[model samples]
Target: MQVDADSFLSGSSRRWVAHYRKNLDRDWQIPWSSGTALTSGEKQRIAASIAEFQRGEASEAQDYLGKSSAFSTVARDPDFHAASILFVAEENAHAALLLRFMQETAIATRQHSFSDVVFRWLRSIGDLGWSSRVLLIAELIAQDYYPCLRAATNHAALHRICDKIEYDEKAHVRFQTERIARLEAGRSDPAVGLRRGLQSVLLCGAIVVVYLEHRPVLRARLSFGKFATTVLRRNRRAQRAINANRRCM
Candidate 1:
C-alpha cells in the first residue's frame, strides 16, 4: 500500500493492526513508550517539532517526484528509476509515520513556513540521478541524529516511535547502499564517472541544506555543533567509500 502523511495519520491503527498484529501490544522500547511521563506542555512542543520535521521531509519528497519526471530522460536505466522510486517511497513512509503518531497523541503543532522552499530545492537536485547516493547519506545521518534525539527526548512514547522509525531507516540504508553499488558497477562510460562526481557534490550540498533547515530542532534537542560534526564526518566517510569503489571498478 502507498502510505503518505495524510493516510498515515488518519489510518495508522488499522494499518498497524493489519501488518504487525503480534508486535502491536509489545512494550515500545524507545524513549517515549509511556505517554504519561511527559507534561502536557512537553508533549505539545515535541509534537510541534516532529510535525515541522515531517513537513520538511514531505516537501522534499514531493520535490523529488517532480525532479524524477525531468530525469526520466535517463529513466530507461532501471536501477536509476528504481532507486528514485524507492527513496521517495521510504521518505513518504517516514512522513506518514510521524503524522500518524502526532494525531494519535492529539499533539498540536503550527506548520513551519520554510518547508516549501526546501522541498523545491530538493526536487531540483533530484534530477541529477543522485537519489541513491543522497539516500545513503541521509541514512548515515539518521543513524547518529535519531540516536542523539532519542536520548534527549524525555517522553517514553516519543522515544519508542523514534526507535521504530530508526530501525526502519537502518533497513532502508542497507537496501539503498546495495542498490547504489549495483548501479555503479553496471556503468561503463567515462562520462558516467564525471556525472557521478558531480552528483556527489550535489548530494553534499543537499545534505548541508537539510541540516541547516533542521538546525533549530537539533539545537533544542541536542548539541547542534556535535550533531553537525558527526554528520560531516559520516558524510566524508561515505564519500571516501564511493570514491574507493569507483576506483576499484
Candidate 2:
C-alpha cells in the first residue's frame, strides 16, 4: 500500500537538492530600522518565543545525519542517504533565517536553555526513527507557532520571514512523517495501531506544552481557546492523514 519507496524518496531528494542548488546564493536580509517595530510586551513575547525556537532550529538535524548514515548501511538507496543531507541543509537554512530575524528585532540569541538541554538529551538516546518522531512532534508545534506569528505581525520583514519559515516547516513535517511511514510500512496491524495511539498522545502533550509556554505570543495573536483550536485542528488533521495510512503501513 505504500508508494514505491525508491521513486518517492529519490525524487524527493532530487527535488530538495535541486531547490537547494537553485537558491544557493540568494541574498535576502531583513530591513533593519533604528527602533524596534514591536511594543515592549510584544517584543518580550517574540524574544521569549524566538529564542527557544531558534535554539531548537540550530540543532534540528546535526545529530540525525549520523543515525541516517548508519541506517543507510542496510538500505540500498544512495539518494535516500543524500536526502538526509539535504534535509539538514534545509533546516540549517531555516536557522540562519531565524538568526537574522532575532538580530533585526534586537533580540540576542541564547546559547542554552533547559528545554534545549532536555531536547538534546532526548536526541542522544534514540535511534534515527525514534529521534525523527520526536523532532516531528516539535515540527507540529512549529507549524502552529509560525503561522500565528505571521498573523500577529504587521512588519513586512517579519511577516515575510514567518511566511517563509511556516511554508518550509510544513514541508519538513511531511518529509519526516514520510520517513517514519517507511519504517512503519512493514509492521503488524496491532503494532501500527499502537504506534498511532502513541503519536496522538505525544502530539497532544506537545501541543499543551507549547501553548502554555508560548501563551504570550499566542495571546498576542489569539486567545488561549482559539490558539488551542487552531493548533489542534491543524495537528490533528495532519496526524489523522498520516495515521489513516495504516494500509500503507
Candidate 3:
C-alpha cells in the first residue's frame, strides 16, 4: 500500500527522531575490565553468536537512502530523512560496540553468514517497509538475545554493553513499530488485513531460522521452549504496538 506522505512522518516519527537524536552524542564508552571471566564453553558460544551480531550491526543502509528520502518527501516529512540518518547512525554505533566487544574478547568476525546474507537480501530488494520488517525481526531476536547473554556471561563489561544496546533496542522497536504502523495503516482496509496476513508468514519463517542458527548461544541460557516463547511474546508485543499506533495520530 502507498503511504500517505503525511502518515509517513506522523507525530510519532517526529517525537522519536528528537528522542533518538538526544542520545546520539552521549559518550558510549564502557569499562572493559572483565569482573567475572567467561567459561571456555560460554566464550565459544558467545563469540560465535556475537560475531554474527557484530556483522549485523556493522551496517548502515546506504542502499536504502535514496528510496527512503523519496518515501519521506512524498510523506510530507522531509525531516524524516534526517531522522532516518540518525537512526542508522545509532544502529551503526551498536555495530561499533559489538565490534569493540569482539576485539576485547578475541572473537573472529566472518565475511558472511547464512542468516546475515538472507537478512540483507530481504532488506535490499523489497519495498522500504520490508527493510523495517527485517529490522523488527532483528530487534525481536535481540529483545531476548542481549539480556540473556548478559545474564549467562556474568561479565561486567559485557553486561554494560548489553544494557546500552537493550535500552536503545526498546526505543528502536518502538520506532520501527511506529513507522510500520504508519505504513500499514495508510493502506485500504483490505490491504491492511492482507499486509498483516502476509507479514505473519514472513515473520514465522524468519523466527524459525534465527532460532535454529543461534540455538547454541540461546540454549546456553534458555531452553528451546523458553526461547521460542520469548520470541513469540515479543513478536506479539510489537504487533500490538503497531496496531495501537493510531493513538499517536
> Each candidate's lDDT (Cα)?
0.55, 0.70, 0.76
User: Which of candidates 1 and 3 reaches a greater TM-score?
Assistant: 3
Best of the candidates, lDDT: 3
Worst 10 residues of 1 by lDDT: 8-17
What's model 3's lDDT at 100?
A: 75
Q: Per-residue lDDT of 37-86 in model 1, one digit per residue for the tens?
A: 55565564455556666664564455555554454444233334444565
Worst lDDT run of 10 residues, candidate 2, spans 27-36
Candidate 2 on 1-249: residue-level lDDT in tens? 235745665575567666656655655554555343776766766787877888877865567787887766666556666777877776777788878877877888988877777766765676676677777777777876887776665666777777777777787777777677665666676876776677567667767777787777666667767766776676666666556543443
lDDT of 3: 0.76
The candidate with the higher lDDT, 1 or 3, is 3
RMSD of 3: 3.2
Between candidates 1 and 2, name the one with more favorable lDDT: 2
* Candidate 1 displacement at residue 26 in angstroms: 13
Q: Give the TM-score of candidate 1.
A: 0.60
Badly placed stretches (over 4 Å) of model 3 are 1-10, 27-29, 34-37, 246-249
Please give the clash total of every predicted structure, in order. 10, 0, 1
Q: Looking at model 3, which ten-residue stretch has the lowest summed lDDT?
A: 1-10
- Could you tell me how far off, in angstroms, the CA of residue 12 lies in candidate 3 after the best superposition? 2.7
